[model samples]
Target: MPTVIALTRFGPPEVLRPLRIETPRPGPGQALVRIRAAGVNPVDCKLRRGDFAGTDPAGFPQRLGNEFAGTVVALGPDVPADGAVAVGADVVGSATAQAYAEVLVVDTAGLVVKPPPVPWEMAAGLPAAGQTAHTALSQLGVGPGDVLLIHAAAGGVGTIATQLACELGARVIGTAGEHNHDYLRSLGATPTTYGPGLLDRVRALAPDGVDVVLDLVGGEAVTTSLALVQDRHRIGTTVDRRAVEEHGVLRVGGRSLPALREIVGKAATGRLTLPVRTFPLREAVAAHRLVESGHVRGKVVLTV
Candidate 1:
């Protein structure tokens, strides 16, 4: 039996409770993984609490994990040829539902291998947020000589996206709370204070205007993003789902993606870096509360 973590109800982080059940066996094209580390994401909490209005919740006593870095312990029949992932390959992706457990069931398509170099926690936490940043930049056509603005620059996606934009030859200015200014600078971004005259701070850096924006914080940030860039095509948001449905903020490519393969490749090859804070799987409730604090400097993970 698997001791999976689930929320019997939706409320505070305390709702996340451990429950024991039969270990799942992968079907024809699946594999069973012993989760070494599971990534903690805001979307995980939002969906867990039914606070995310963009889609339906996964069902009560819902298992709560999207990505993890783990070893393949068992393989189902007809698994991918090459069997590229052997019994002990270190890998990451979104397949850890009730993943904050001893073991998990996974689909290969949701998997990305972590070469011997990356640590388990970093590998576990990078996939989703890194991919979201990658897709946002890719879709906006951010490149050399571009000027980009990234909202919530201290958060998981913002930190990764800032570095990526800088690597693309784009002059990146990031909006984060004043406390995180130095942190953003370390990622090669010009930190712009996010409230009260946000554009003034940006204008001080860009002079002309930004060429693209990746909004991780929604609400007013969506309007602020549009106001900074003339072309609406240049702005997109991952958190602002309402903006996508009503106000016209474009949906980023990776949101609808089953998994991010090539972008994860970037992290695997050292083209990207993941910043993470980790908690043990038994501390799942505390992990959710910490991330929800809105003061996290980077990604968080639950260690199995």
Candidate 2:
């Protein structure tokens, strides 16, 4: 039997409880991974609270977690023909609400090799935030000479997006609290305090006007982006679906294997970095609370 953390019901962090279940066997084109670490995301908390119940209703004892890093313990039928991954290989990738367990099965298509130097905690945290940031920047056409404004720049997705934008030669202006200003600057972003007067402050940083905006915080952040960036297509949001429907701002986020490999390669070569806060697997409730608090500077992970 293997232990998995599941939400007995949709409510709060306390609903998450450990359950012992039979180990899952891989199907065709799948691999069974002994999970080393799992990432805790804001969406996990949302799902627990039934935030997306209209579209993605939960079944009782549903698992939580979308990304993980671990070692391949076995491969299913027809899995090793391409030679991309094999038994005992270290890998990282996106999972579907099932990464918060000791062992789980994943499609080979979604897994990428985790570099030797990248720690399991960081690798686990990378998949969701890394892919989201990469996709958002690509959607916004962030590249050389572009001035990118990133809301909530000190948080998980924003941190990766800021570094990736800088790597792509964009000038990044990131919004964070005053406490995280120095931290954002270290990641190659011009940090601005987010709140009351954010538009004016960002304007002061980029007098020519922002070329694009990646809004991780909705509401005022989207409103600020509308005032600062002229083109709606160049504005994107991961949080505000309403704004996307109303203002035509791009909705960004889809996992790409190429993007995952690229980010992992950068991390391996010391070109990209993500800080992670770790807890043992049983402390998933604590991780959820930290994420829900909305003040964590980086990502949180559960070690199994």
Candidate 3:
């Protein structure tokens, strides 16, 4: 039996409850994992409050959490034989819904092995934010000599995106709150404070123009991003799918296309480094509240 957290209803963090239940046997093309840590994101908070409207309504008493790091312990029929899917080793990626549990049953394709020096918490934090960073940067053609702007630079996706863009030799101007300026700088992002004149600050940094803007803060930033960047192909939105679509902003967030394996591989080998603020699984509600409160510098992970 395994214990996991489930949200009873769409409400504040208090609605998240824990329960002890039996570990599920892997179904076809599935693998069972003894979860070490679970990544918490702003999306989890939005889903808890029913803020975003997109996915087909999941059955009630829904399990939350997406990215997680764990070890393979059991195999479902779907896993290929001949030891291609290694068991009893460190693994990381997304799950269908059971990530909050001590054990997770996920698609074999979703799982990837973690190389040495990649901490479990960092691995847990990678799947969602890492993929978003990778896809958004790739889609925007972020590269050397490019001046780019990234919104929410202190956030999970922003932090890694800043690093990746820096590694790729792009001049990254990142907008976070005043408090996070130093941290953003540490990650190799030219820090700008968001709110009350983002464009001006960005222009001051770039002088001539910006090649791309990854707008994590949707709404007005999307419009501002397009205006700031020379090419529309370089602007992307990770948080708001609808607003981006309505305004025709580029979208790099998940749209049923799973990129966890690729994301995990990058993070595991150090091409991507994610920060994890860790908490115990029993504190799932507090973790959700932490995300909802919106002061997080990076991803939050729940340890089981």
Say which candidate scores most in TM-score: 2
Q: Write candidate 2's Cα lDDT for 1-304 as tens digits.
A: 9999998878888899999999888999999999999999999999999998999776788998999999999899878745868888999999989999999999988999998999999999999999999988998899999999999998889999999999999999998888899999999999998889988998898998899999999999999999988899999999999999999999997798899999999999999999899999999999999999888787999999
TM-score for each model? 0.92, 0.98, 0.92
Instruction: List all candidate RMSDs to the true structure.
Output: 2.2, 1.1, 2.3
The all-Cα superposition gives candidate 3 an RMSD in Å to the true structure of: 2.3
- Report, for every candidate in turn, its global Cα lDDT versus the true structure: 0.80, 0.92, 0.80
Model 1 misses residue 198 by how many Å?
0.9
TM-score ranking from best candidate downward? 2, 1, 3
lDDT of 3 by residue, 208-282 (tens): 888888889887788678678656667888877775667676887551234566656566676766677889999
Candidate 1 per-residue C-alpha lDDT over 106-170 given as tens digits, one digit per residue, 9 for 90 to 100: 77766777777778888887777877887888899999999888889888888888888898899
Q: What is the lDDT of residue 275 in candidate 3?
A: 72
Candidate 2: pairs in clash: none
What lDDT score is found at residue 212 in candidate 1?
Answer: 89
